[model samples]
Target: MPIPATAPARNTKSDTDPDALSVLNHVFGLPGFRGAQEEIVRHVTGGGNCLVLMPTGGGKSLCYQLPSLLRKGCGIVVSPLIALMRDQVAGLLEAGVKAAVLNSTLSYEEASAVEARLLAGDLDLLYVAPERLLTPRCLNLLGRADVALFAIDEAHCVSQWGHDFRPEYIGLSVIAERFPDVPRIALTAPADDLTRKEIVDRLGLNNAPSFVASFDRPNIRYEIVDKQNAQSQLKAFIAERHAGDAGIVYCLSRAKVEDTAAALNKSGVEALPYHAGLDAGTRARNQDRFINEDGIVIVATVAFGMGIDKPDVRFVAHLDLPKSIEAYYQETGRAGRDGKPSSAWMAYGLSDIVQQRRMIDESTGAEAFKRVSIGKLDALVSLAETANCRRSRLLGYFGETPAAAKCGNCDNCLSPPLVRDGKVAAQKLLSCAYRTGQRFGAMHLIDILVGRLTERVTQFRHDKLSVFGIGADLNEKQWRGVIRQLVAMGHLAPDSEAFGALKLTETARGVLKGETEVMLREQVAGARIRSVRTKSRRGDIAPQIAGSGGAANPGLVGALRAWRSGVARTRGVPAYVVLHDATIDGIATSRPTTLAGLRNIPGIGDKKLEHYGDELIALVKAAG
Candidate 1:
């Protein structure tokens, strides 16, 4: 290969200029930019530094990728995972962009060749992990190369206690001191206020402009149900609505991940297990199968995050509650990446609360860190117990003011849970906890409340207390709800030393004294399955959208998808890497019959058109 000369150092032209627009149209195959993308691209291409907090699948890549192509030399992207780098490079290659990854996956000679190409200015983009990017050899190579920009993707990893915390990411701040002239952009999805500040201070991006997009992902429907036979519930959920669809099941522990995967497989669902405990080879193979094949569900711990490049995940079901609202948001946001309707369902229960709180209480971290963790857990609990729209409160947690009080996409807004005054119920529960020496869990406490003389209750001789049988007005299930709500409200907490025993917080005193009023969602019998209908933004009832991009014709969607799958198999890449679901939906709806017709659709750039245009057109014509 010949050495390519570098162009000008900076292009101050607007992103909508003819050259930028042409590149967007002919190279990337998108007619226009999404929110804040064009402005961020223009600013970075003009040699400015910035920070971006856009939701997942909100086109965060284009903010830096476009500037990389339009400016002087190759753009260096700081990716957090090797899988993400590989997926990104694969997608870029299919779009006719020269991209490469330098990670553990590459041999010594391959990495050296990539370095040589970078120095020769023969590449448009380079994705490197933070550990490798911070190395002396890699830093020196970057110094010798004609670099156009530096993009810190998943920038929130710099936070000390973030869900995706990586110690190596802190070293990335050195980039600002070493490469001062190169315009840098740091991007993350749905970061909280604390994480935002940490990214600025730790990455040395305080001086950069911050572009915060709406945290709302309108394509996803959020639902939280009380946990009841969790494995069976998950099975029924998949069977009723998401049958044969690709979804993720999250477990809080590695053992649970393995168990869930095994259970799902036994239940006739194709599933795989992913966690840190697995060998690297097995993990890699499982991840590859999940990505390259269709209709495969991966039950995983947090280990399978940020690296998922699949765009057609129909749902993300949590078998347990997440530790914090931020963690929950990031995990659930992985669904509906292609702008089609999807589901974020979670099974939350009293044990989840106890387990999460116990973990925080038992952790050996400093008191300050534990305090922050507790606060985060409290916020997530509030979200789970809220009677209002889940989206409204979820967005509010990240400091985004939603446009409406009700999102109409979540379970609460759809059914509108009945809120009843639970002040008396809360007082009774708190009083019972106090009278019983606060040495029992919710289950044992419930037995006493509903006047049940179980073996343990008889052993404890607790049936003689005044508070016993005081809660008979409410059934056992409703009393359980009241106790759960009390714990959620901080009037009650689980004892770390007593193994699921309940304890009273200082706030419990006020509730017992009738100084505070409590409102809680009334417990009601839930059906085995619910309708999938949802209200769109205009308040019109819209049928459930399936497959990618909500194509009107199910038959055409299936035919187009089969053709795309064959191509993906031939290329040895994920189907989305060949063409995103959005692109498939676009082609299916338009039914393009010619090269020119296909080129007019979004996500079909010049290289994609040249590679698969004729076959796609023929398929569409045949389906017609």
Candidate 2:
């Protein structure tokens, strides 16, 4: 492929052009940008590189989309998944942006038509998968086209720390080498400081301005309950608080996904299973239903969510432990994307931690990689076991300290855990682990400590140890909690070489010597009551949302939803791609009666105003 000869510097005439904000308002129907969006836009429009680390639903799309339109030529977007590209293109078209996607799924004629548009400069943006864009054929075509810039969406795919790492993303740096004049912007919804640095290094954006926004998703009420009968707990969580509400229940295995979906179905909640194990067509159809319909719960593995662009997911429940904090953050970020109240509910137990650690220990990766994986898992364990404010701990993980130490939106802040000094308990547990040669897992240690004369205990002759049977005061679950918390707090480390055998770390010395007091939550006896708070718990102040409107008229909201569903079905796209339920709620609540009034609503952009303005106005008028 022939490279284009030296090209002129990218035209910066649009940098000072004031029409960008006007276009944002008139075309996209947004009054203004939020949270570093305007600054990022100006930087990119002035032909500068940027790495945007914004939270999900934080308007990362606008950072690139606006600049692409403000600049002179078509913006090239490199995305990893076909479903994501389709959703983005559909949403862009709804907002009046001329966007097309080129992927392997397209037919010969479809591909030709997209290429024709590209050559004619008839598109504002073109979304292509990284594999497609890295091809010699596509590179040669891009070398000759009047390219504006490159927007690498979900750019964390370049980092191994991210949940959805894609090897194809490694080749995206070519855009920097080849189209040196055009600005490049990389965006991701989740990345820690290390991952952020790796993204910059790997994407060759070392000199680019990095914008790190706050990772606080205050709209999501964080709740992590101890697991006991996870399915029943999840069922009660669904049946009570979120009945008929759209949500996602994530599992770590395909069998669990299928079982959970089946259980929810039998219990009268409409649920679908999604995973790599499902037939491709079935997965696609299930995903399409999830996108287009409302109140359908999807039970899935991690493979189900990164492609979901729908904004109204009311909750995200985890049936098992996520591999890392990054994965947990990204998955929960999917909920409440529209800035509505939602929940990040989870049920975790000692088994979850042991299973996750074992997965890391048994992995074929190098020791360095395994160490990093353990560190990541330990951080997640910390989050799960923390008696502190969930939001504060979560934010602190991302290097942000919230102004308020206690965020009232989380379960810990709402109903504080019963924290007690467990120094004696810790010493007992640590003594039992050490006396047993630190070669036993938590269950074995628990058995040894609790005087359970199991075969292993008799074979190992641990029953006679001084520390053995000394922990009989604490039940099996309580001992497990002590061990798990110690592991999380770094007082204990898992032996990667011995299938997660308990090993005393240096931190354990302080406890054993009584120099450090271990504080722990006293285990209360119950059936592991699901912490899915359906209403205000005892001694909890209700969270105050500023300027909250009265509840919308259900009849009006129902009518508006019916209209949105009809429009989405007609357009052969997801209902959210057509119009989010949040936008429809705004319309129904305000009862706007004219096209001009309807356009003034927050989410009704130019294309929507032009296409659905009459219908919305008519519906609003008739609802009265």
Candidate 3:
């Protein structure tokens, strides 16, 4: 059903007015708002300040976007990246909204044109970077315009303690101070209690109502693998489910990024490297290709992904552990943004943990900051080593109540391991680390417990000890999991003086003395299967992707993608910017035959329907 043409563009009616509903259906092409979207939109439209913590694909953009159209003046958005601003402005323009961006990348003529639009009150929204927005010249221009509101995206950057802290963001309070009468909104997807409070205080949004949506993204499946055969495991993982799909492979260093990209290319995956070390132009070109092309994976360090607006990223694989839980969440949230199923696959081992801790300990920051960083890393370690549902543990970190006791979407829930009374196992491991002079890391401690008389064990002649070989029952990997869990549980602490050595903490004494009962998740039957769809857990995610022997129509999806690609190429925009694969899934499922039928599809907005309705209907019919 098409939206009635008589619906007004702007309305002064109440919060529950019909005009907003019309815009929701006609402009964005959705049935209605999800979660707190309607409430936030109404508040901002009615001239109230707010802070929104919505997940990816939760339509955070519409909270400020709809208000900009209905309110008194242009919405001034202070975004962090030029790429992000450009993507947003382009999408809004395609939707027939008057949106423009002012950033360094813009040419002189382009910037002047945008300025003319701003001054002429011809634009509904103006996206600008923080540096440009804070300038004296831009401030002067904004003062002259009838500003509707101020929106600060990626608001978490203002927290000095956050992983992605931007010094320039600390000055954004000027938006609230200068535009006293105008409403303001600050938004971020992932922020803990500390980061959230800091964002409010730093952005001067203290009085604004804060709305936090559930942190659980059930559409994304989480899997953490112990780093055995890292390269082959990555290849198999990609080949199994995400073959010829767009994805990201995150590495900890630039050299690793290049090496991983090279390895992936050799293995038949079209891969590219992206990092700050490359020339600026090369980096930009690579980013553009990844965004605009299909089946291309970019191997990058943390330097990428902050301002990325691409939505159809199929997976995010971490070759190394991130600095903190917040970093991991923000990075992995990039995948499956169109609300289809995706995977967050990570390969973490003892070395990753050691390197991370050493980096924190050896950093130039204050001791207080280092302490907080270490605390954050410990939380991530817990998530990786957790025996329960991964979704529950992740959501708990962000202060959201778990959506379900077991999400049935993660590795643990899909292939639950037997939990055993690990009190004795914990005692044996802690005792070995202790009797070995408390200066050995997990490997050495495991070797000692497993009675392996390697060079280190023999050089010290420590194999003659009482605790030696007591843990022979547990294999090396199982013992490693125990040690990792022990460190995460705070019973074992990494000793700085000993250079990544494991040391018994005060909490270890209780475990050794049987005063604390330790429970550990035993290894699954065949964890080292060395395939993409390894074990029973892969079955949980197999149904999401086409050609995985599930219910999806692979041929129909392929045809729709080809059509979307041609349309996107004609418009010179990324394929997802025109239509997401999830929307393609809907078209394939419903097999809509006419323009009227296409209007009922969620992603087919007023502009898209008008532009591509005939071609889409033709394609669907031909496919049938």
Model 1: lDDT of residue 103: 91
Candidate 1: list runs displaced more than 4 Å.
1-16, 527-553
How well is each residue in 272-369 modelled by candidate 3, as lDDT tens digits?
99999999999988998999889899999998997688887889999999998999999999987876677899998878888888899889999999
Q: Write the per-residue lDDT of candidate 1 for residues 176-235, one digit (tens) a residue.
A: 999999989999987777888999998778888999998888888889988878999899
- Model 3: lDDT equals 0.83
What lDDT tens digits, residue by residue, belong to model 2 across residues 213-323?
899887788989878799999999888778888999999999999999999999999999999998999999999888888899999999988857889898999999999
Top lDDT prediction, candidate number = 1
Each candidate: what lDDT? 0.84, 0.83, 0.83
Ranking by lDDT: 1, 3, 2
C-alpha lDDT (0 to 100) for residue 156 of candidate 3: 90
- Please list the Cα RMSD from the true structure of every candidate, rounded to 1 decimal place: 3.1, 4.9, 3.5
> Which residue pairs show collisions in model 3?
none
Worst-scoring 10-residue span by lDDT in model 2: 1-10
Alpha-carbon shift of residue 449 in model 1 (angstroms): 1.0
